[model samples]
Target: MVEESAENVVPPTKGGGKKPKSAAAAAAEPVATSEAGNSPATESKVPPKKEKPPAVEAKPFTEFIQQDYLPALTQALADKGVSDLQLNLERAKIAIKGFETAPECSQVIGRWNGGNRQFNVYFFDDNIQGQRAISCVDLGHRASTLEAFVIDERKVTLDLLVAGVVLRLNSQKWLTRN
Candidate 1:
């Protein structure tokens, strides 16, 4: 086998490869002169970066609560004979007026799986469900405690809402909190 040539090897940069060149640095490159002939420049030529369009700003969590989640959550609760519910827009939450023994007592906007999808999670003892979730059996379910189905935005139907309230009554601290 032929021995590897040291001349052919490129030195590794601190970033493990060619560092990204800024647009300003690329623009500051000297103009090539004809008299310079075929002599190579010290800096390696870097391709100009493509300019990207400004990203559209997305509406905030509270906006989602007011617009999408609140409507669905309100209707779901109302359909299940929950008449005293009120939406707290300032806090981006909802609570029942005359409810005793509130578990899953409040709901706030939350995301799952790196924020790929939007969803609502509940609060236990008025505690926010931030990064916490429960199993799926409580949607009109009785005694299937082993199969825990985490709440997701797509699965929060009227049936699940009723079941979730019931489940929240027996809410256990998340396994992680243990």
Candidate 2:
């Protein structure tokens, strides 16, 4: 597993954080006992095996993004003309479409740590006037404007994060940031 520091450790989900149970643990039907003249030669006792998720250590960030977050968030961001965003599965880095020409301070910012499997996203809007500047970061954007802050929950799923990000981007407050 990637080495996770406390700074990027997302809180664990409130429930159902463990892996799926093996089929034997999930079987619900009653089986015949020896008293019922059950013949070992004619009886089947094996249960179907449960599939396990690949180990995180194999590809820490890639698996999570490919299997969980991307599927849920891709369509939504595409609908907003922000498609083409790519998560560097190897790291917490990202590339947002249409940010190349924008001032560095006005571009979207994303950072993450694979070990802790947590990330933060920020979008800044700024206007420069005759050597003066005003920006969302300077104005003190609200807590909800942050993807990480909005995604805080005991049980955070990719779908939940997608919804939160979409909502924040579409809000009037965000639109008027500059």
What's the true lDDT of residue 109 in model 2? Answer: 30
Model 1 clash number: 3
Residues 1-178, candidate 1, lDDT per residue (tens digit)? 8776885454567865795555677789876644535324523464558997732212344454456556766666566444555544333222323333433334554222233322334444332222334332222222222222344644333345445643452353211132
Candidate 1 deviant stretches above 4 angstroms: 1-59, 89-130, 133-178
User: Distance from true position, residue 10, model 2, in Å?
Assistant: 69
Query: How many pairs collide in each candidate, listed in order?
Result: 3, 0
TM-score of each: 0.26, 0.33
Model 2: per-residue lDDT, tens digit, 69-167? 565565766676653444432321123344346454322232222222222343232211112111122132322222233423555445655676566
The lDDT of model 2 is 0.42
In model 1, state the lDDT of residue 170.
30
Alpha-carbon lDDT, every model: 0.42, 0.42
Clashes of 2: 0
Per-prediction CA RMSD (Å): 17.0, 24.4
